[model samples]
Target: MNADRTKYLNRRALMGAAAASLGLAAVPALAQDNSTEMDAPSTGPVHNNTSSFRMLDWRPYFSDTRNGAILVDTTSRALHFWSEDQSIYKLYPTSVPLTEDLTRRGRTEVVQKVVGPTWRPTPAMKERNPEWPDFVPAGPENPLGTHALYLSWTYYRIHGTHDTRKIGRRSSNGCVGLYNEHIAVLFGLTKVGTQVLLV
Candidate 1:
C-alpha cells in the first residue's frame, strides 16, 4: 500500500484501540495533518488568539474520565479537556509526532503549568538539529506557543505551537502541540496535579 493509505490504516487501528480502552461510544472521524517542513513558521508573539479549527465535543467520551483530567488520543491527534464533573469537555486538535518510542501511554500527572514558557531543546533535539539554541525564549519563534502543561513524564508536554497550521499533525518531538488559543483554554482548566492519560 501507499504511504498515505498506510498512515490512514495505522491511525484507524490506533484510534480503535484507544476508543475501546476508554469505552468511548464512538470515535469521530479525524482530519489528517498535512503540515510539512517546507511550510513557513510563524514570527512574533501571538496573543489572545481564538481558534477556528475543529475540536471534539468530549462529553460523550468523558463521562467516565476524572474531573479536570486530560486524555490524549494520539491516533486522532486530539486532546480532551474534562471539566470538573466530566459532564463537559472541550477538545482540541494536536500534533503527535510519529517517532520511535515517542508515545507516552499510561497515567501521569501535570507537574507544571507555564505561561509563555521558555523552551530548552533536549539533547535528542539538539542532536537532530545542532543549529537549535540551548534555549528558545518564549515568543512566536518558540515552539512552545502560548501555554504549556508539563507532564510528570520527563520531556513530555501538552503545549501550544507558534505555527497554527501544525495542529492536528504528527509533527512534534514527542510533545503534544495545540493551537495557541486552544492551549489557553486548557491551561485555565487544568491544575498542577490534574491527571493525564495518554493512549
Candidate 2:
C-alpha cells in the first residue's frame, strides 16, 4: 500500500486500540505535532476523535470548583473544565507534552489570561533549537494561537494552537494545546485563579 494509506491504517488500528483500552462508550485522543492528513475520512460523517471522549466527573479530581476547575489528563490527552457554580462542564481534546520528561503533573492555577498572546520560546526551547526566532508577536504565525491561560508553573500554559492537527496528540514541547476555537471558548469560561490540575 502507499505510505498515505499505510499511515491511515496505522492510525485506524491505534484508535481502535484506544477505544478498547479506554472502554469508550466510544471516543478519541488529542493530536499529532505537525499538520497532518485528516484522520477521519471526509467522504462521510466524521468520528475520528470521539471514541475516547467520554465525560468525566470533577469530584474525582477536585475538592471544589471554586473559580472553576480545569483538569488536563495527559494520558487521555483531554482537558476538562467545570464552572465555579458547577453549572458548566466542558471536555476538549488537547495536545500534551512530547515526552514524560516534559510532562508536569499535579495542581496549578490560571495566574493570567491573555488574548492575542505573543510567543516566546522557553530557554530550554532556544537551547534545543538555536535557529528558532527569539520572539514572535501575536498573529497567524504565533504558536500560542489567539488565547492562553498561563499556569502557576513557569513556562507552562493551556493555550490555543493555530494548527488544528495538534489538538488530539502528544505534540507540545511542554504546554497543553487546544484548537484555537476551543481555547477561545475555554478562555471565556475560565478566569485568573481558576484551579487547574494535570495528570
Q: Estimate each model's TM-score.
A: 0.68, 0.75
Clashes, model 2: 12
For each predicted model, how many residue pairs clash, with residues at least 3 apart or on different chains?
A: 0, 12
Please give the lDDT score for candidate 1: 0.69
Give the range of the ten consecutive residues with the poorest summed lDDT in model 2: 32-41
lDDT of 1 by residue, 150-171 (tens): 8888888888887776676655
Go through the candidates in order and give the C-alpha RMSD of each one to the true structure. 13.1, 12.4
Best by lDDT: 2
Please, what are the lDDT tens digits per residue for candidate 2 over residues 14-124? 988886785652433322111110011012222234214657889999889999999888888888888999887788888777678878899999999999988877777
Error of 2 at 167 (Å): 1.2
